[model samples]
Target: MSPLLWAVGSLLLLSLVYVAPKGATYILIDDNLDTELAPPFVLLQEGKALDYRSTTVVERLMNGLPRNALRPGLQPLVGLMALLDPLPAYLLHELLVRLAGLVGMYLLLRRYGLPGARHATLCAALALAWAVLPTYTAYGASVLGQPWVVLALLNLRLGPGRWSDWLVLVGFALWSSLVLTGVFVLAAAGMVLVWDASRHRRVAWRPVLGVGLLALGYLLVEYPLVYSLLIERQFVSHRVEFDYAQLAPGGVGAGLIGAVRYFGLGQYHAGLFLRAAPLLAAGLALAYVPAGPARRRLVQWLAFSLSILGVVALFCGFYPQLIGVAQRLLPLLRAFNLSRIHFLTPLLWFGVLVLSLRRLPAGWLPLGLVGLQLLIGLSMNPEWTLNVRRLLGRLPATEPTYAAYVAPELFARVQQAIRARTGQRPAQYRVACLGFPPAVASLNGFYTLDAYQNNYPLSYKRQFRPLMAAELAKSPALQTYFDAWGNRCYLFSAELGKNFRVAAFPAQVVHEWAFDAQAFRRLGGRYVLSAARLQHPERSGLQLLESRTAPGAYWRIWVYQVRN
Candidate 1:
């Protein structure tokens, strides 16, 4: 098929197989809710882009905004979706981003001199694999800007021969920095430059100049914000640590095994590296192939892959305990999970495999492998298909919940109860969820006292540490509400009834032991909602106004008006 036809066909297939299955609208939950939905909602609805910085308890206690230095570049994309209803807008944004990555990947392969048909087929195979790959799909739906970052890196590798090329390169570099993934771009570009220089026995001035300009641009854009945040210690302090067992040789080995399982060549397995021996051998053989362009491309791919792994290894080796016993001290590492970078591993292997396969009789093996990968990916991991089907099925319903993280009917009922009880406008008063997820309150636009985010302010740390210590002293059961960092709260759990001390509240009011009604009121919370039954509904000055089970939900929502 012609390139145009191939492009069109692949685009359609991807949209149908991946994007459309998720439907036009779906609820965001967990990290997706916080990063993609809440922040964007704040920016679009309230015109307060920085509000997310202070939404967390620690951030608010700090008296100033927490440093939200990352992902500032996503504001425009979020803003563009303002007019469209949220679900469609989010779905559209995700689709377009993935499509851009696909196109960029194709162009990148072509730039390396891969033939048209071969590159197109590879692109299609990638799309197929990505459609069912949970990690890639999750990241794509997130606001992390990973896909755009990949696209930017591809553009950077195209080399800046024209003035427009230079403009695009610089623009993307600045944008990448704003999104906080500039580190990867910088690392990749720097590695390529060094490799090129070493090969030619001379400096590659253009790339060096480009790198300098990019760094200058990033500094100009982000340094001030970071500096101020560091001074206040308002930046996110969560340290991501990997078990030493999960690093490179072990983790990579497991991933290879998982990939083999994904190809249906082996039995289902848990470790990522189970059947990865042959695949690794194939990749290694390709890495040493004699074709000039293929060798160069393989070297570049290997360098990029190693650079990412090296960073992870350095973190695991240097800072095994992301945050030591002293909770006050900030962690050296910010991004917690290095495993997310493993998303690039498949692409790296694919690149090398394609180059190595170029010399083979090219009709069936590539197509067969692609088919096997897709089949195994879908068959072994049924959630991909199930999730897509659920999303699509829920779209026609009045309010569809994603993974049941937030029940739309329950959320609406809670919002109504709050409005009726408070006799105030929506979003006017702070709220707390005793035996429910904070997202339940947050999804309805209430400022929640029980909230969590990566960035917690120092003031909050100081304030909450003592309070948490006091509470834990009173009832050790409260330990369940606090994370290892002791800076965030998690009240929602199946064992909440067992873990929370009910007697902590003045009235027989439902309590999670982490916060009493007084503390709730102190934090400007006027209402406390519990999913579990309260021992004394009318005790402790809290008026139980509504106790009703939400339709289609198992738990009952008990809404209380806290007394002043």
Candidate 2:
């Protein structure tokens, strides 16, 4: 290996291994860990029978059937990684990320060799920029399939070496939903290759056949998502707006952790460069030089086009639909469901910059480019922040505390009560509980049936509320309980005679998949039953069992046995 490339490799590895690890921590309590994302999918795999949206899709694929379910609101993305093991896909995806990085770097650089070292160096710079970004890698990395988009980019740039390259692109689409929007970045690039081959009069059949094959492959692979989105979009109003006024810089200070979330973690950090200005400058400056052959003129053209379409496509897909709400570009810019869609923006910029700097002498282009990136990043500095300090001060393990706060420690107590009454035979019970943070995971351990969130925030319409209220009225004793969607039945804490601003309804939210503005409402549980039931005691064939109490600030359980 050449010394220059070897030196570049070492630098990349050291920055990711040493500097990156020191600045980040992945445990809960930081608010950004987003761990709840994976539990349900893994829960199903652990033999519990239930499904979230992603899990539903994957389940259908594995079980060989199409689902007719339609869910409302944003759902968690954790189901994919959760299907494998006990530990909720944490370390597994990190390993995949590291592996993708290695593969991305090797293939990316190899492809760059044709363009010569200077341009190749620029492509290398995209790695460093995205690696440090918060949305791109920081919180986003906690997600398992996060790196495949960039990995797919690497393969697309590899210029169709083996037939396996096409398979990799298809594989990436299956693994993560984030790539769904940005995938056209690849589809567009592939179409260009077909165009170029036909223009050059070379092995033209490959490009034509590849595009046809790619189109058909994506059609088959994305059938579920395509079908779901098409039908869903037609009936319900996603209310997604893209009113362009939010592009202006606003009060995105320390408390607003989501400010640069759209810009990618690397770009986010780089955006506030006064602290690491010099270091970031070094990274960006070093990003513009590519190494390799002069025959890559065609490939370079394709990269440049992709770089443009990628930026435009990202803006169009999300921002245009989000204009009225925050009027913010950063939020809309997240091409995927998460906020890190801007990670590759720097990649495109670096590509053009590398092309520009390819002719410069040793060290000259690198220094100039780095300085430029810092100047631009510092331009958006959001008044100094305490975000870093707050992050460090969070509790080491927040899952346990959050668990206790959301549900009572009823496992051992419930197990004992059931065993004493029924000779310890765990039956296929059809148990039900109010949906909360920990109910589904906690209940399936000893209950009759699987647990799930009844629906809210996503599909909370005015008509649905009365039906739910009627159910609550029929079961007055369950006033303090959670309903099918896991909402409170109003006896414990009624809605206090008001509708929520977000939803404009008389409903309450227990949990949401992602941040929906409508979720920040006052949750209420009221029964639509006859006033007779509320005033008089209802007789039942139920008998009292051992009611073991749990001491906690959250759930208050009152257990009984039915002679059904």
Candidate 3:
């Protein structure tokens, strides 16, 4: 098939496999549902995306979260989200990210990996697989657009590069996050430059210049992060207490297992396309290739890829010890995760896929490999899986569609009920969620005392700790989770443990609730929108205001008022 035919075919497949399902029954849960989806939608809806003021507060979340705590709005994807409604914006973001990957990888492969028209179909196939790798849309093109950065750098390294190469560098830096992927990308680019310089015994000024441009772009785009971390010294972030030691594997065997799992399958947060098949394909290609430049290049890439995996594995394996020592000395190291370099490995593995495909002779073999990858990508995608299950009438009652997840009508009823009961609007009082994510409240325009925040004031964390202290005492694991990584500073239940998704079907009950109502009220928490019913609410100083249920709503929220 020709390039145009391949493109059209891929787009159709993307629509059938991804876009249609997403439009129909978008699954909203976990990280995407709680942390990422709401912020962009809320910010855009409330007309706060353009507000660059540091003092600006997003009143809907964290009892007035600083605007800088959310993602910066100086990107194309953010602009796109700003233009559309929540669901449409989300779908568009997903589509754009996928398309960007497909185009970028195809162009990169055409320029460097496979240089002829005969290889165009294979390039498209590989790129399509890369495009559909189930990376989180909230992250924009951080993982997918990596090939664009490489292409831009390679263009500069080869010669006086085109303006498009410079455009790619700047555009990628803007689209991606410095904290998430940009910093590591620059590091990788710098490594390449150093390696080239060492081999050639000379410096390549163009690629160096390209790298500098990309870094500068990141600085410009990530001004919010820069300002918050460096310029603003008023509030220390809760991330300062992040305890990697508690999370990391303990013994050598367990560490090795952790390393091996990560090296092979990758963490879900960082584009979790399993690398086993690709690694096997690469190994097979390396073994079979003739003794020549092709073999030499294959060997070099294999060694390079293996080295990266080895370093990442070892770092992950001994992360507890390494981070312990580093944090003890610096203390600043606790806030920032150095393990995120693992983010770049997915891109490297895909690159390996391209190389492995090129090494093989033209046949069904390469096509079969591409087909297998695409299948894996689709199967691994949570959204796709949920949609497929829903389509087959097998979706669990716990799993929610986009409509059911938000249930704007249901929340409106709750809002009205609260106002009728208290004679005050949602804005006049703060709320926190129990047995469910605060995202539901936040998304429905309620000012929440508790929220899922990647970065928030440490002072707020300290204040919030009191409310959950008794519950935390019962569960040492919950204590560590909240104190060390208090991202989800919700009202944790000792009975519930870490299971927050308390839907109506399970009929969850918290037997012995030890909530500090005084602390909750002091923090401006007027109501607790709990999915789990408390057996002894009076003991916790909570008056059951209303038990709300709506037709199509996932949660049977039992609204509890903190008695004065």
lDDT of each: 0.47, 0.35, 0.82
TM-score of 2: 0.48
Runs with alpha carbons beyond 4 Å of true place in candidate 3: 17-24, 291-297
Tens digits of per-residue lDDT for model 2, 217-283: 5454445344455545322211122123233233324213333333223334212232233234324
Error of 1 at 74 (Å): 4.3
lDDT of 1 by residue, 262-286 (tens): 3323211111222232254356446
Off by over 4 Å in 2: 1-43, 46-88, 113-160, 190-208, 211-223, 226-346, 349-361, 364-564
Could you list the CA RMSD of all candidates, in the order they appear?
7.4, 11.8, 2.0
Model 2, 286: alpha-carbon shift in Å?
Answer: 14
Query: RMSD in Å for candidate 3, one decimal?
Result: 2.0
Name the better of 1 and 2 by TM-score: 1
Weakest lDDT window of 10 consecutive positions for candidate 2 = 525-534
What TM-score, computed on C-alpha atoms, does each candidate reach?
A: 0.70, 0.48, 0.96
Distance from true location, Cα of 445 in model 1, Å: 1.9
Candidate 3 total steric clashes: 0
The residue-by-residue lDDT of candidate 3 on 1-564, one tens digit each, is 678467647755655543443334665478987777778766876788868687888888887788888888887667876787667777777788888888898888898988888888878888888887777767888999999988888889897899999999999988887887888888888988999999999999999999999988987788777887778754689998888888655677877887887787787777776776687779779877989997997899888877878788678667776887889999999998888887888887887787787788888888888888888987887877777787687877768887777777788989999888779998799999998888888778888889898899998999999998999999989988898788998999989999888888768888899999998998888899999999999999999988888777778889999887
